[model samples]
Target: MAAETSDQYETLQIQYPPSHRRGPLPLPPVSRWALGSVLAVGTGGFLVLGAALAALVTLYVQGQAELREARTELLAAGAPLLPPNSPRSPGETPAAAQRRKDQLGRWLQGLALGWRYHQGSIYFFSSERKRWDDAQLACRASHAHLTSITSAEEQEYLARESRGGTYWIGLVATGPGGSWHWVDGSSYSSAQSFWAAGQPDNSDHGEWGRESCAQIHPVGNSLWNDHNCNFTFFWICKRDLSGP
Candidate 1:
């Protein structure tokens, strides 16, 4: 009976497979090392990608700052930077330049005041009253100067267009008893003068001889008068379309 039991045990041992000798199957040593290597390679690649993204972000920020500084400098130099598609050729056609000028003049006139066009020039009338100095400043802000009358014909035309309203002109005395000149630095000539009779008396009864600024008074055929520079009145702004 002992020999029979020993023979049965040997048969059972022979029938068991070599793989089932252990409790569970285990990975080869090479495969475990390869898996760790792959994880390390992936971590290194992620770090490289993160560094590249940071560099790109810094470059973008610096580029924007440079663009802003360039624009500021251009504005300071009075050289307006137009869009890429704008007329940039140095030898622009006269018709094209005139069209651009007219378009810009129309846009400016439409912004704050109504305008009248005559002889390649645009005249804008102020909607609100302002002092002579304020009016001149406003005109300059609009890329214009206060109206400078050179002829009786021109003065008559302005008076007609303005509908007989009291308005300031560009004529102002440079100093006490000084010569009169237009805002454009042109000397006011007696040949083009349109003063009203007994006007520019330099009355000191109210504000002294400070009445040095000229105005196109509505009374007595729309003639001009030298009034106080501080007096508030409507004004005219004129811009030449042919000007650069």
Candidate 2:
């Protein structure tokens, strides 16, 4: 019999040996609609996947930009030196406690940009120079005071971190009785003092005032030096983690 024709099929003839005579066999049907449907579904799925990936990337970039903007704004506003509040009181509302926690987090985030939280205190080592009095004022502005190293460990850490640079500490010579004193009301003798040999000799540099202010001289060793209060130098300030 002759081959039948159809809109859904394509046919091809297969050659065979003359001894095995037979009529042309019909080829399997190849539907245009099925092929188009498969291509369309595959393409749509790939397009959807690509769009999803693009959306994710866009969201990530937007989130990072917002985060950076928020951090910059927080730092510019300055950080508070006050410690986080104590655990919520029995009468305190949950909303109030949450607000306080969020505020504390903002403070910490701003402070982390320029201060190091260490051993119940946050210390700031400035790279800029200022006079002793000006440096003290700067510290006060930050709700801190020039470093009054209360322990040997603090002294050692300051010396190490401040190596290769001189910094004004809290020590001064004009106490109540013309004795050395720390700005935080601690006497120089109270701290684990490490004055350089022959320091505080009251050298005036042949100027108007005496060498009354103390600075960290970490060149040869972690020792202290007496310098004129008017002298400009880098400074170190520490804010207590506790409240009064």
Candidate 3:
């Protein structure tokens, strides 16, 4: 055994078995005349080519064994098996796409939108409430961002699931008078918003600062509101496929 090595970003743990000797398996002889004069067709070439073929066989067998062992280890640990590295193209089949999504669901486990994953992103709703900044920090701790509602369908789903609970969303005031931004770096200026009537007026209402952060709080059946950043509210976290 050896000590593990770590850096600021990651730590690696590797263990190697003791070394062993390996040699080419015994192979039947191949006549030099069968190959060609171009192979330097000498007696030595005959032996070398035979050994090379045997070595290739041995390497293939060894690689297959290693792959099986690794797959077994992953299964025993309840880990999701990785899919192929190729990107999905139009020619890809539905079965392959489903397998990819299933693998993602297994990896996502405790945090996803149940089975309704949204456009390669998962959602996590916090149980406790916090100020807007603190809520964002909490989501970041999980390698996620505060959720941003991008479409009417998504907003409907969130509102229905929220069940009257106030949640701090990712939108924050980026400019004066109704200008807002989502924290995930997506531009929402021209996008559809769910602002309630007369919302985001930057009212003080005796609070120290004006409303600056957005939430999924409903007023008169509307789903968006601007609240003071200091107010505590449970938050939703969105982790895209690119997130850790």
Best by TM-score: 2
Write the residue-wise lDDT of candidate 3 on 1-244 in tens digits: 0012113112322212134658766788777775665566586788999999999887666545544554455456554445534456465576765665555444345332232244455677778878888889988876678998888888888888777877989999866565688998866854488887666667662534677888887554538877767767788988765444
TM-score of each: 0.56, 0.57, 0.53
Candidate numbers, best TM-score first, in rank order: 2, 1, 3
Q: List the residue pairs that clash in candidate 3.
A: none
Q: What C-alpha lDDT do the candidate models reach, one value each?
A: 0.69, 0.69, 0.67
The root-mean-square deviation over C-alpha atoms between each candidate and the true structure, in angstroms, is 36.1, 28.8, 21.7
Summarize candidate 2's per-residue lDDT along 1-244 as a digit string, tens digits. 0012111112322122164758777778879998899999999999999999999887666545544544454345543222356677566577756655665564465354556655556678998878888999998987789998767798888888887688999988785565887897655663478787766567643544567888887544767877767667889987654422
- Model 3, total clashes: 0
At residue 128, give the lDDT of candidate 2: 85
TM-score for model 2? 0.57
